[model samples]
Target: MTAHERLHTRAWVLHPDIKSDEDRRAAKPALDEAVALAAALPDLEVIGANIVPLPRAQPGLLFGSGKIAELKQTFSENKIELVLVDGPVTPVQQRNLEREWKVKLLDRTGLILEIFSDRAATREGVLQVEMAALSYQRTRLVRAWTHLERQRGGLGFVGGPGETQIEADRRAIDTQLVRLRRQLDKVIKTRGLHRAARAKVPYPIVALVGYTNAGKSTLFNRLTGAEVMAKDMLFATLDPTMRRVQLPDGPEVILSDTVGFVSDLPTELVAAFRATLEEVLGADLIVHVRDISHPETAAQAAEVDSILSSLGVEQDRPQIEVWNKLDRLPEEERTALLARAERGAGVFAISALTGEGLELLLQEIAVQLRGARHEAQLHLKFEDGRKRAWLFDQDVVREETQTEDGFDLTVLWTARQAAQFAAL
Candidate 1:
């Protein structure tokens, strides 16, 4: 190879299956997901992946010394330059393992941070990821640097122990955090203004959310006819994208494609991405796209639900479960899943890639966005011109007769709109 030629880092992925953990996911699928995550980074070449069963975690090295020796042999044979652990690793464990295996190490959180750093496109996304990474780094600074012995000049109030390396690093991170937060706040304010402007428009928002690589972007492209980045990769779409499209036999609506969720999404990320996820909160309807062919679909759905609930998406919020990737399944399984979906309300079976059953899904979305409507005759007094105007503005008034004391109107409106009118 030429000296200037780029080379991918040889990496191995390991998911530690802890027996004592009550919430541990199945080992094989978890390891598969981890391997996919490692491959998502352009520079990493995933050479091998395994699920390392652990009866109990060792404090110092995570894996037992015997198991560590075995892994080291395998890694050395494969020329692995990096090890990706699919779970939390303490700073001590990470340092010890790297020293023993003579390889760079990254825990699940660190790997995710790397992916987010690589995928973030917008200014706000970049700032949020940097802040979250700094927060994560602040927790693992002990012995990470060699400057702990040196001390800078302090404010001369005599101190027994002067600033250490970790303390100085943390202070530096705090300063950076303050700056990033300021920038993020400004960006968030601007986004809020944009959201408020969108609200003034007549289009309702429909948000697509699901586990990573569940075909959301494909569905989004099919619905909006915009060529977004749709690939069979984790987090192919990190920054949210929005487009306006008219639903068939329905009103024009804004379709929002959001970042896909994953099991055990880093807490720092959740906090950092709040500005992005606020779009979901404002959505009139949510479409959860699922890869129905996957073995862990149920578990994935639960994780998505947990994250949504944590985000304060109310149970009563209108939502549809879209069983996507129907074309990938065998005929027998496809029929079974479709039958099951038919037994539920607000559920759809479709192949977003092939555009199968999309018309039905679109029709359902239109119905959900419209909500329940009823025709009623409303009598408003002359003093209630504000209410009368609101009815007209909503385009719900069918016929009106102006009387000396009042206006008599026939209106078709949803229950929520009626309540708003009553409030007026």
Candidate 2:
């Protein structure tokens, strides 16, 4: 088989609970998204999907023996090679399911990890993914090494190779974890130095965050004229990219495109990606770009909000919600979206693919960046030429006058900049 065909296989989704009408209703969209994601791959096919309800007190397997038997037969008939469970399954549970169905079984976390591993491009991103995968695999090693039983020596102490294998695996994983942490720490320190330098220049940072394939990069390119790699695939842009964007007032701010968030993101990934996500924490403004055309856009928005809150960034910062891809919507739907924007909800209806409503959004961002401070006039002695030069370098000077004793200057700057001047 070719590389694509080797990775491609038939997938079946099994959601463990569909007990009520509401449960089934709520699960349909998630199942649909999973199927859509699966379909995006070149070789994967979704032959069958079903929701199984479990009664109280049954714990060994999610479904009863009868259901398992039927599922096995169905898997055989459909030639399904893999089962994707929507919920997390224990290593033991996964092993049992694979044995019972005679096929590979993966839980939601594993599937997401696989996608991330495939999509990661940068060395840091790949290292982070590898760390997360190792952390996940350490727990699942039981399934892979089950044949090696724990044997005892002559004196009933721990035996030789068997015990050594377990210890060696644990020690190797610990060593790798420490090395990854050290590397990540270095990256974090470098980022901190960069942030400090940017602070000295003091350009407002505007970060774009949203669900996967929500046109964040498209809008980012439209606003900043940057040619970042934007595509329709999930997790297409894993590395954060930043560009200097000039506002309507000619004041420049840095706009950053961050990795997109998804539902039920892997815990290890969240921890691993925290260094990259520090950009959001340092942002002056956040542009939340949503694919308003998606059926579950609201739920996806909630997921983004939840992740932001977890990052301790949901509050205080000014957020502009851009309802992107309006051109794909029906006329009435677009009108309603505009009505929502008119309600002073910090929302804008825009088509990033085309150049609609972008100017107004840029103007609003400029207004926010401008409203952050006041202008000041200063008089300095000739010996204070250094301070004048410093002011010119650090803050926006609106007006300047030179005299024998001193130089007079008018500057527009933040209060923090003014304080820095006073210290000078």
Candidate 3:
């Protein structure tokens, strides 16, 4: 490649700290995360990052005129080719900013869409990303460019200007959205079939969820012995991965590693990826993994919980909080965290990277999954040997007696185990 072509695009990340917003995060960590997000995309050299404090956002340009002038001067001096805003930017604001700065501009949603576009691996993931990107693009088609107004000729039989360039483009996007929806529906149907198949075999599903870069993938790898992409990078694991793991002295479970949640995740993405996130919805237990070493661990956990709630996870769903990354904490802090975990029900402190406290965590998982056990009797026909064998395999059967037409077995099991046996 030529030197010119090889040069990475110079980019600056700006996280707007809105002073008026009571829920606004601290500026420094937010800016750091925004910079990391920018760095996740290929071919972008993040030269600098800062927190742009605003008492109120300007509707036309996001930043006030003075701040815009100052930023323009900084961009020119730094030879920046792109400005990435780490918050929502209106289409008008985006256009105005790009024109004034004479460089490309991408908002938080746009940047995330680009990252998802690059990271998607599976067919469903790709389709989901495309649908989300199109949804985002549809909102930005508000004459951001003069070219969108340019008209093209249609069939001679048609009337005036056919449709405007913008109309044709939007219609094209709508058509593609429809096509993608059809393909995605098929994929979702296939996924449902797989879910049903798994239900028959019915190992309890344990889902791992957390904020981005919270070592969920690392923990998933350590627990399941699968080579999922685990990295100290945001959105490293996009596609949901499932593996069957047998707990020591306990029942086996299907462990699902899902996409990590982030604060202010794009609405389009949440909608498009609903089918994928269904894994979490169907989980028998939710493990909320946390990077306990991070400074904003509490805030991050809140964000994850908020997203889970938004996704319609019921309040009564069994959940365990895993305080991960203990190895990264200082000795005193680690000891304190461990002590705190001891006092907290359903909370465990561990380092996924070092396999610390995993044994206790596993035990807790098994205990939670066991639920409440009760004695019950099940009747099975001669042709239902498989069901009877499954009950035996689960070690839930207490006694059995053969009748002329069937076998009556008494079993002591939790409702979860009984449900699995029934599915068999």
Global lDDT of each candidate: 0.87, 0.78, 0.87
TM-score of 2: 0.79
Off by over 4 Å in 2: 1-7, 18-25, 37-48, 56-58, 142-164, 371-424
User: lDDT tens string, model 1, 325-395?
Assistant: 99999999889988888898889999999998899999998888774456889899999878887887666
Where is model 3 more than 4 Å wrong at Cα? Answer: 1-7, 143-163, 371-424
Using TM-score as the measure, which candidate wins?
1
Candidate 3 local lDDT, 67-101, one digit each (tens)? 99999999999989999999889888898899999
Span of ten consecutive residues with least summed lDDT in model 2: 17-26
TM-score of each: 0.85, 0.79, 0.83
Q: Report the lDDT of model 3 for residue 161.
A: 46
Local error of candidate 3 at residue 293 (angstroms): 1.3
lDDT of 2 by residue, 1-424 (tens): 5675467698888777646334333567777666655554545677888767765314456568898999999999988898988767877677778989999998878887777777677667888888999899887774545544444346655554456776689789989989987887786777677775765454787899999889998998888788887777667677888899778765789999998888877798888777667788767788899999999999899999999999988476778998899999999988988888878667888999997888888888887777455667789898887887887665356678887888788776665567668888
Per-candidate count of clashing residue pairs (backbone under 3 Å): 0, 0, 0
What RMSD, rounded to one decimal, does every model reach? Answer: 5.6, 6.5, 6.2
Better of 2 and 3 by TM-score: 3
Question: After aligning candidate 1 to the native by TM-score, how far in Å is the CA of 196 from where it should be?
Answer: 0.3
